[model samples]
Target: MKKTIFTIACILSLNIFNSCSEDIIDLKPPYEEIIEDAIKSEEDVNKFLMGTYLKISSTSLYGSNFFFYGDLLGDTFFRSNKNFGGYTSLIMMNYDPINTGDINFYRSAYDVIQNANFVINNELTDSQLNKQYKAEARFLRAITYFNLLNYYAASPKSGLNQDIGVPIAVYPYNPDEKIARSSISDVYKLIVEDLNYAIENAKAETTSKIYITKTAAKLMLSRVYLTRQQNGDAQLAYNLTDDIINNSPSSFKLFTSTTKDAFKNYFSSSEDIVAENQPETIWELDMNVLNNPGVNSSLSVFYSRTGSKRGLLAKQTFYDSFGTSDVRRDLFSFTSIPVEDNPKGVWMAKHERAAQPGGNYTRNNKILRFSEAYLNRVEALYQLGKNTEALTNLNEFASLRNGSAYSGGNLLNDILSERNKEFFGEGQRFLDLKRYNLPINKGTNCPGNCDVPAGSKYFVFPFSEGQLIINPLAVQHPLW
Candidate 1:
């Protein structure tokens, strides 16, 4: 079965490469050539699916772009002085209305979405194969749309439904055709629907926690419901995810021995990972520095200082947020080694991997974890007025970092702070800020009045001008 699947995957990959290249260049081939040669068998279909997975390695999405844009562009982090050009301009509030970085992110997200749609719409028809592959594709599509919507459109309640989101292109593209921006509601609706289908139809045996599985679908649904303020649905989704964690064959345990072990083991190793169908992880980007050079290069960009060139560093605020007792502070941040041209300064945690004497650094980009599931359950319980249950779960996680148990305050606030500390530099701060409706500290470095009070606009990024050009129907987000 594995060999058959592998062979099919290769054929499908070749087909996708030829098809995508032809579409980009506007090659006019006969209709029969296009349809008949598209995909041949179940094996071909599997290969096309692999191609979609391959695109995640691109710099813009799961690769370096995810690390840099998600962390550097937000507060609580900054570019290292050695590697501080466009990044300083970004974090220091120097982005213009037409920033090229924003444009690159926009195009990259669309590229991933397009590949997912191709698999969903064109490949996999056998009932067994269709069920498995479709679920994976749907999960990928939903994740891509979620990222794009968060970056390029307003939050759901911003009344920007009429505003164009990134184009929802869901098929083989015809270069000559014009696409319009989809409404935020429509886009979200599609995302939810896709996730629901994936949850119901995806094969449990073929799934793993690291890859998209039924639990991942539930987790994503919870997230979407929370974003839309659908409390009941959110609670339902969270409950479902929690049940998976509590009852799954794989156990989700926090590192109770020490903070350093918690950070290092959780992020850098697979000890905490729940396999495909288990509970600890719902979905994770499959990244390894050994076979996948793209993920390796991207992470290297963040930590590399080959002379005076540094990439990004931890912010002073982030360092200050932790108390003297918090060991995560030391584990996540580091001082630079003195090299001939590179002066020493504080660098962000190279926790993902240790520097190799002459070999490349390698680590998986963990997109989700069992810890997140525990947090989700706690938050949902709190929102549902089950404060006691929420606190119980909250303290359980906190106790893992240190031997001391948590004495909780405001349930929501405790959850937020816990997330901030646990997930710092993991590309989750901005989402936390948006979800809690907290104002981002524009601070002294903001280009205009740093004092502009935060609200919905602060949470939503504006659509790129280039995207608007291609899809004129897309409208600028309000209060941009």
Candidate 2:
């Protein structure tokens, strides 16, 4: 059974290498060709790891769609007529099982997982460096699995439907063997186990924030723990985040200054393709001029009016969610006067670039940062019944962003509201809403379904009909 799945992964990886090579020119010696050599040397292992990063950085995955899909599914942004029509079906939520709108992203994720599996299943010399390499591989595989389950399966907190999860392929299965979705609990178990290994053995420091590090692993683990919400998991999550915020030896620090420039500077400068100087950045995908998602697929293009294909615009209600005095509000601006008459709508300055409209639209995609650590800790504290402590921390975080302090009201809602404000274009709102089982409030800008209920089928995306056909034991998402 294991061998069969392994063979299948290899075949898929070959197709990925051929089709994806043009976009990923930085990855030397195509991944599929290197697999036959068994990744024996240190250089080969590094190339393998870098190849996985390239896959993750693809436009179909984290480079754009992951963040775009999250915000589009939620109430924060609506598609304008300027869009290329690639995601109209996604926003309308009207696509069928045979033509799932996000098939490219699904395939890209599996390509990454397959690359990681190859690195983990092979061995280099018995050196400490090799252990770290394997640890990084596990971390990549775990995070990829978590993303799959988050999108394709019900949350563990979803109760009845939680048993219907995505397929597990940690080891190769026989060619003749059937494949089936693992339970939510089982997939979460793998995520936690792999992250624990990453925390114990991954590299502590590297030249840039693009590489996986122990701190990034800890931050990611806290997210997994918080999402699962099992017994004592909140406390565990809080501890991990707290340690990173207060005790970790790395240079990570929250922005405490009152100046808006300080807050704006936290994001990479427009001239920067890869920012090593940003202290808040824990992990970012390198989008240098040499390798970037082109203008058609770049976030800079989709979110800014300067680009030809600009379509995503901030909803007015969501824009108003930020108070007038809040520094975060400075990140947005109207392209026309009277707000209502603006055809381009409100532009989010988060993904700024120094280029002309037709120039390179490169910008580093930040995956993890210090701000998220504080948010995670605050939520964990609230869950642990430490209301006063959570409030204190929340206010401290808010004050730094030049925002009003939170008075004692509903703590969870306040925390979530802060997250919605802080992570608008960064791709977190929809998933946050889903894990908490909260209804998606589309406000008044919705073009299709106005309100998606807590347990709606739309919350969990469907597998394409081709996917189900290839694996007979695989179950299509319920009600798709």
Candidate 3:
């Protein structure tokens, strides 16, 4: 819980990595002075926990790239006319393992994980508040590990626990030591352990969209189970969502209104989007002028039409897939803006900024929401062979979106298609594709060279070249 960044120079020789890649250090505010025995009391533990939240909201971890890559790396997006070669590697369908962007994500996420471990191991205070704080820290740790697994390891359909996963750190880090990658099965064991502890100990007072709570913990656990998709996992996931939906109505109810735009209203800038009014939000990151992720890395800088890069634009085919009456299509930009040699402006209006200065960068991030939980349950119920129940849930959600209801057909494809429409520009498509073992079918909007085969190694990103050289114990993923 110290305010100091845990310098990992002893873990990896910084000289091995080029100047472009920062050597994966866990950084806290250098302006603050270090305090010894800092986390011994409740106040100190609270400050430390605030730092953990900051790490989760960091640009490298969840602020920008994580959200963008969640879709860009999978499909349904293309390097737009705004492509200045920034994310060309991602669009090409073969990532440069040593690219600066990849390195930044890998390092930033691990840094956050290490901080959580530090809190879980320490926090000697026996006070009730401290216990809840430590439990929240553990929940953050579980979420970080889960995201890392999504990027660094193969899906359960591919190898389950047999594939290599990122290192699992459960104690305070010592720079002199280095740890090897754990097996995916081994990594998940710790993840489940942490979440179980969090669910039992997390306090009700800490329940909010910006922080971890029992509901968020349950939702994350259901997501983990859904991804694994084992024999009984679908049933387990369905039950977890059903429990949350049936109870916790005051905390996790979907937004409702008499207005026509109720379904798409939340994405726009409004007072209703706040945690208090937006009970539908399970977790989010607060972003403002003072606490923004800087100019280039700002959340709006990639998706909004005002962004310098404007990285994400719906393909023509994808745009047509949406029903004419569906209001979600209003998020895309149809206006034509010129690019150097590429096509004109095919941008997203969903993430646009306010007209005022600095408003472009000032956007709160929604990490998890109740709508996603609702969709998760639908798929799980379908997988459990409860088609009637699945369709009922699907119809409720679709009607809310003003989209057509599901007729009798392939339940699996119907569930996935519903997810695609509901979660467009929300960074859920890529992982869903992976979960379904679907191919990367690019529309006319994507890069020309991007046509990835199903189950390609490209789907699994590799460690930075510097990581392989610096950490001898760390093994490079195949075909890196």
TM-score of 1: 0.79
Clashes of 2: 8
Top lDDT model: 2
Please write out the lDDT profile of model 3 over residues 173-289, one tens digit for every residue.
555567788888787777777877777888543434677787788888888888877778898888778877887647677754424355445666644343233777777776665
lDDT of 1 by residue, 275-346 (tens): 222333445554443324442355654654432235555555556666666656555545453232232334
Model 2's alpha-carbon lDDT is: 0.75
lDDT of 1 at 62: 71
Error of 3 at 157 (Å): 1.0
As a whole number from 0 to 100, the lDDT of residue 334 in candidate 3 is 70
Q: Kindly indicate the candidate among 1 and 2 with the higher TM-score.
A: 2
Error of 3 at 436 (Å): 2.4
- From the highest lDDT down, the ranking of the candidates is 2, 3, 1
lDDT of 2 at 336: 36
lDDT, candidate 1, at 296: 38
- Candidate 2 Cα deviation (angstroms), residue 195: 0.8
Q: Give the TM-scores of the predictions, in the order they appear.
A: 0.79, 0.89, 0.87
- Report the C-alpha displacement of residue 388, candidate 3, in angstroms: 3.6
Q: Give candidate 2's error at residue 118 in angstroms.
A: 1.1
